[model samples]
Target: MAIICRNTIEAINHLAFRLDLGPDDVVVTTVVEHHANLLPWRRYAKVRYVECNPEGTFEPDAVAGALRGNPHPKLFAVTGASNVSGWLPPVGGLIQLSHEAGVPVLVDAAHLAPHRPLLAAADYLAWSGHKMYAPFGAAPLVGPRRTFAMGDPFLAAAGRSTWCRSTRCSGTLPQSARRPDRPTSSERWPSAPLPVPSQPSGGRRSAHNEHLASRLRSGLGAIEGSRVLGPGPLVPTLPVASFVVEDVHHALVAARPAAEWGISVRHGRMLLRPPLPASLARD
Candidate 1:
């Protein structure tokens, strides 16, 4: 049941190899991570950034004002939504101000798992797989106790049987990732997809992706240079859009509806945001 194919980066390498993180551990990302939850936790922890205002959103007093002029944080990664302004990161007031500064909050909810649903109170919650509708497989991180640990035997003598650790928690996960309630990543991958019901079915949690994102926000609100960023409840959104058409070329209006009718959508410069200006990042 561990079918975690939702916006993939193997959920930040399953939370940095289940937080065996080092190099003076100090992770805290936000600028809108899609680089698979920010480059494998920035190639193994030691990063701190949380900025995205000027109305792009991810505010909690602008991430506690960038964790008060930053300088060595413990951990505070975020993104419960905002794959180019579907916008959502207030996540219970940024997990109560990064636990009142004891600092520990990870959530990359890759475009908020196709629409929305996060049980809140987080220590971790990574995401990805081309943003949740599946076509890329595996990516999820929901950490705490032991900060993240599933077990790795050089990913099992390199037979690569889905890199073991009981396939990262087995069938019907979340009883602390199951297996008599956690027996170590289920002997190397395969089992962990059945805990999506704290209130499943439109009452909450990806209820068929918020009913196909409210039919893509009523068809991108009848298009025309569009306008819909982080509407309602901050970011429990889908039908994701970030428009400004006019002279066109937002990749040719998203590639002329995917070359006339194929329709897939998604343009540039949202690689967590700041990485633009390399000549508008090779448009």
Candidate 2:
């Protein structure tokens, strides 16, 4: 899942940048993002943040309202699940809202790659394949051909690749294995990134995550103060849970070595910027 584009947002832009999209192309996204998904689209466009409910699940109607705020939102972004809370959002209605407004919807499936169904209801979807039992460094941008046609040739020519950073990619690679007279496509496109190595996902990792989900639910059974968030029959959250621990700092709890015993996890607001205080993260 190597993201060859400069970033996930760049992948989105490269996939849809040509439809004469402009600064006025208002974009709507939830405050909860992986930074990779939110930054690029917001960088070149107006981004409206949809608020999450108290339980951390996104209010689908708020997203619909935001899309209605602008005359025609060029794009809408949302997470398949909160990286922090492991909450899958109400995507169907949100997609409907954007479509009703003639806007294209893009789901940041980075976290959901390990949880939710891959292509639920987004017009232009972005995800990290590396997260989906694939090798590190790969990501995916899935969209219909019509949506992909928005890509601009200039963006392509600029050689803006997310995973490709070294000048060697844009320049020349003398390490070419190609014969002197043979010019291969991979040699020509030095930045060509390979997606995560295809692996048979139906294996121990799957069983392990599934077992973790069951164990977590059983452990939380009839808890006096805790409540589950998002859809019921919880569609396989990644060996991760986001319940509150009274008087406990999530950061500290997440940092505890015990967390590694189950599965390594990060704890915080899924949306990195809007809710986090300056002190929590350095500028």
Candidate 3:
């Protein structure tokens, strides 16, 4: 089943309610997750962060260790891709580990869906249409129907009802009449159709982006006093990269180029700070 919302944040908030998380329940998540993935769990449950390597990637052992330690984990939440470093973590491996421990996984695919296909093993997936070149204000949370039916409704809208009465109402509505009571998967999605382009076209775009990103990485590495964050060569990554210049604030680096050469780049903490060892930070 799918539940449509304004954005990924709203979808996560709704899922949090459905989970009925409390102080006793822990949610295992990675340190490299976006605020959209972390904040919701933090607000509703006891969050146990699985530390990622300096490159914003995690090994299967790390995830398994976290799951083993948390005896009462309600869910495992992770991002399909790092929004800042553009690193695509091993989501399939993580999901497998979580499932072995009897835990469900929620994937925040807002960044990954636009660039790569999602892993089918994920228990729940959330993405925004705007991230994939569609108009803003439409995001969907896809998961099992039983999951939604197991919890309280996220909202108290009139359309959620099967019948109404002025005084006391006595009987259940027929299944056909109660169609509006539970929204079908199709009705929960955007009204407009989303078509997938040919695989050849997508492959061409991916190849081109990879070429440009490789060049960008090489060029940035040659520059004096530059430090790039995330995994080394041959790792699948988005066309995006994040770096910091030695002895310079990120804000200044972003501002100077835009002001002088009309070049735009994102800076700051990127909403989530990955754990970096002292040795890596010193570099």
Candidate with top lDDT is 3
Overall lDDT per candidate, in order of appearance:
0.58, 0.57, 0.76
Q: Highest TM-score: which candidate? A: 3
What lDDT tens digits, residue by residue, belong to model 2 across residues 105-133? 87876676565456656776676545545
lDDT of 1 by residue, 86-113 (tens): 6556687778887887887877776665
Q: Candidate 2 at residue 57, lDDT? A: 61
Instruction: Give the backbone clash total of model 3.
Output: 0
Error of 3 at 161 (Å): 5.4
How does candidate 2 score on lDDT? 0.57
- TM-score per model over all chains: 0.30, 0.61, 0.80
222: Cα error in model 3, Å: 2.0
Which regions in candidate 1 have their CA more than 4 angstroms from the true location?
Answer: 1-54, 58-61, 65-77, 86-100, 109-125, 129-137, 142-241, 244-262, 265-283
User: Model 2 — TM-score against the truth?
Assistant: 0.61
